[model samples]
Target: MSERSFEGKAVLVTGGSRGIGAAVARRFGSLGAHVAVGYRSGRDAAEALCAEIGAAGGTAVAVAGDVAVPAQAQAMVGRAHDAFGRLDVLVNAAGVGPYLPLAEIDEAHCRAIFDTNVLGTIMLTQAAAPLLPSPGGRIVHFASRLAFNPLPTSSVYSASKAAVVTLVHGFARELGPRGITVNAVAPGVIETDMTADILRERGEQILAATPLRRIGQPDDVAGVVTFLASADAGWVTGRTIIADGGLN
Candidate 1:
């Protein structure tokens, strides 16, 4: 694809204020796409990203809403559509991954993870699917490597991501006739705020196991997302790209 291949496209990235979501938004913005940076709480970060994109000769807006809430998720997509008039891509990157042992995993904790990771993806897709242009719509979701290789504390979080992988298959088939592709990226141990503690505690151990001999970065995963959203991936759907730096 050309450097500015996404020119004239509009993207809405949930959880776009920081981490992988922010990188995805920036990638889209740099490629000439208008972006909607959706965030649940990081208003300052979200607006700053928008300002940065605008200063760099791109268009972006900070949209605030809780993806875990169905009404809020719909309204968030609606807000993005209002900002750009059309939605070409929907990136569902909003998620939580707090780890807890099975014994300590209460109903509240499990619900929180599922509500955000699973339900949020569904609600956002439902809202954006109609607005996306037929024969070219793209939906990229953020799953996790834990869904494939789980740790003891990852019981709940892994289950949530597994649900996402299943949804990708189901939604892709449901939306295939419309030419809207649904897919996911499962990242492993990316160096983001979400993984700082894990890296600090076991960075060396992880690097030793990873064939790439290093940790993953937000941009590393972001590139995969943008590809899935780009024209090159038109015939690809219901797939999960593993972005683990070969750790698994």
Candidate 2:
């Protein structure tokens, strides 16, 4: 791909301060796209990422918002649109995964998971839809392998992700008339702060099950996300690409 393949395009990545979100933002910036790194609390980290992208001769800005809130989601999208003059891609990487067994899963726990993972994705997509250019906008959502291959103590997280995949399918059909493509990526056991504790607790079993015999890196997921946002993926929509290294 050309270094400037994404030139003139603007991307908004939620939870872009760290982990897979950060990697996605960096990849888009590296490809000559203007990036808006949206964060909930990691202000310093988000700013640092923006600086790093800037140092690499790319355009990036850090925007703060809590994705679970409708107003905040709208503001984040508005800020990115105002800053870049246009929005081409929206990556919903902001999510929360809390492992709770069915016996212990309560309404509060379920609400928290759904609000952040499902509702957040919906709100952001709603807010960005008007700003996205017609006939070529892209929407990439973050799902998880657990959505398909569920495990114990992850009922809420798994269900929320399953909802995300369904939402992507519905949105793809609704948004297809506008020329916008919607898709989701299901990443399995990536090496990020979010998965550090889990890896320490179940790394051996997880690695043994994975055909690759190793944990995935954030960039492994980010690369697929970048491709989904590229023009080459124009014909693809309403599908979830699994990035689990054959763990299933």
Candidate 3:
């Protein structure tokens, strides 16, 4: 609604160099939120995003860390507070997807995906939760439609996201008494670099199943994430809002 609704708020977005994460960073920054874009790699893109936000008169800083590591996750939050004043919203958009069939899914691959999608979320949330302001502090994690659909070769990824939704529900209950809200956004078949090939192959089938009959954009999901992290969503907590265009 208002352009400066997030004025004075500070947000940390992980994996914010590109795709949905990048869109989320821009959306929050544009709304007057001081943004910290956290990236594991893709330094150039992360810097560019920070520059773009700065050009738009939004405060932003780029921080690099591997979400898979708890220390790194904490450092990312530390940098955000060091740059801005404190953290208001934490968006766990850092995740990894490995498209391997259930039978072929190796322990190493599964561990890698879970490390980023689940454990990383836990670590980041634990690090930022205390720093968040009580009344309207928010935490939003990115789950996936795959959690429900059980796609052909995404066993590990789907399981990890399912865990994320559970984590949201549990943390919301744990943090509710403290006045901090925890929630999640589950996206389906968004048109991002991660879904390029799937979009090319099963695009028709996916579109047909989606009542909206269209592939979603990163911004489509980002808008919902910003709402979840804002004061407007103060009453909502623990639930995972599905942004799948009716695919699920």
RMSD of 2: 0.9
Q: Candidate 3: which pairs clash?
A: none
Ranking by lDDT: 1, 2, 3
Give the best candidate by lDDT.
1
lDDT of each: 0.94, 0.93, 0.92
Q: Which residue pairs in candidate 1 collide? A: none
For model 3, give the RMSD to the true fold. Answer: 1.0
TM-score of each: 0.99, 0.98, 0.98
Scored by lDDT, model 2 comes in at 0.93
Write one digit per residue (lDDT tens) for candidate 2, span 8-104.
Answer: 8999999999999999999999999999999999999999999999999999999999998889999999999999999999999998987988889
Least accurate stretch of 10 residues (summed lDDT) in model 2? 96-105
Candidate 3 lDDT by residue in tens digits, 135-229: 77999999998887777888789989999999999999999999999999999889988999999988999888999988999999999998898
In model 2, residue pairs whose N, Cα or C atoms come closer than 3 Å (at least 3 residues apart or on different chains), thus clashing, are none
State in Å the error of residue 107, model 3: 1.2
Best first by TM-score, ranked: 1, 2, 3
